[model samples]
Target: MKRASLLPAGIPIGIASLAAFATAMIGGTITDLGPWYDSLIKPDFTPPRPVFPIAWTTIFALCAIAGVSAWRAAKDSRTSDTVIGLFALNGFLNILWSLMFFRMQRPDWAFWELCVLWCSIAVLIVYCGRLSRLAGLLLLPYIGWVTVAGALNWEIVRLNAPFG
Candidate 1:
């Protein structure tokens, strides 16, 4: 691929990822995340509050990198179109999960949305693995975190259901 084209490939994905990150951060600031979140009954396995931002920043960076990698490798036969589609879907779903969970503060709805997010991530890993092992590996923490998040969401739903 031409050098110019390669660079631009990162632009779209990078912008989208950055936008999502910014939206989440801004939403976090504007909303009453503390009271809503703190009032809920959390699980014993929950990580520290400070850990969330760090983990999410890392995951968002990896997500951008993966998109760039996939876009750059688009011409490679190994990078199937289906993989790209799955990646795009995962990105869109990632944004939605935060909106539903944090912004809306709907634990039950968030739990269901997170289940879809988890499944999409699993499929994305398999697809990206075929294109670039590193890309797939990059998303590992994201997948792990989301899996734990799903469990937490489930527990939250069970414990704080009907109102929480």
Candidate 2:
């Protein structure tokens, strides 16, 4: 009986998990902490290289859970679609920032783009939280992580400027 009851939850969880996986894979592939990155003068506060994968993996997992909560709590298809759309937008912005900062070697541009990414995460927290408390609470860590990333990015920009 419990197994049958959980089927509805299984669907959304599976979908959200897949979406999270895709986002992480795509973003991780494009983010290159290569020679250019090594050449930059990072702050002493900068997280060690290993910290990034662990942090991002944990964040994506939580986001998947949050996405499931929001999807299930939504009252209408439109509401569910909206939540999914916002996540998609956030995912795109997330990947783009990596591409800009690491792959393109443009932390300056990445810094500006990070503002929009932060906004997307903020909107996700408010909008998803309205739909489901668990969803909103789950996203709290995401915002915090992004805040730390933003500070790191700001410091990188300050330390390394005039990039072509």
Candidate 3:
């Protein structure tokens, strides 16, 4: 394997993962965001606050790993096609969720946005599975987290809807 090939294989995953990590930390940094979050009446299924960062970090890492693997597979095959497209789609949805929820402070809009994100994630998972089984597996945690986040978003919207 040429060194250049390895670079191509690894770069997308590494770059995307780092971007995800930064976003997660930045999202965590909005100091009083917690109070805003806490004030909302969440569903009983909502996990504790601390769990989110930890879970996101792990999921992002997995996504990066999967990206690298898929990239390597694609590079070897001389094309990225579906694998790369799916990864890009998933990333777009991920960032959109943050922008909708935190920046816009629109949980109602965020709730609907998450549905789009969830669907994109599902498509990514199935598409990644076609390219690499490990890549598909890497998305499982992300899908799970999004599912929970979706429910939380719904509850937040429901609770805040009347007033906001």
Among the numbered candidates, top TM-score falls to: 2
On TM-score, who's better, 1 or 2?
2
Q: Score candidate 3 by lDDT.
A: 0.74
Q: Please estimate how well model 1 matches the true structure, expressed as its whole-model Cα lDDT.
A: 0.74
lDDT of 2 by residue, 35-112 (tens): 878899998999888998999999999999988788777877788779889999999999999899988999999999
The count of backbone overlaps in candidate 2 is: 0
* Model 3 worst lDDT run, 10 consecutive residues: 1-10
Q: Write model 3 residue lDDT over 1-164, tens digit each, in one string.
A: 53336465457666767866765665555424666656767778878878877898888888878776665666444346556577767677777778777767788887888999899988878767777789889889899889988888888787677534
Total backbone clashes of candidate 3, pairs 3 or more residues apart or in separate chains? 0
Q: Estimate the Cα RMSD of every predicted model relative to the unseen true structure.
A: 3.4, 3.2, 3.2
Deviating ranges (above 4 Å) for candidate 3: 1-13, 26-34, 75-82
Per-model TM against the reference: 0.78, 0.93, 0.80
Give the per-residue lDDT of model 1 (tens digit) for 1-164: 43326455556676648764774565456445577888999899988988888888888788777655655555553454565577667766777777777778887997888889899988777776666778788888989999998998899888888854
Query: Which residue runs of candidate 1 sit more than 4 Å off their true CA positions?
Result: 1-31, 76-85
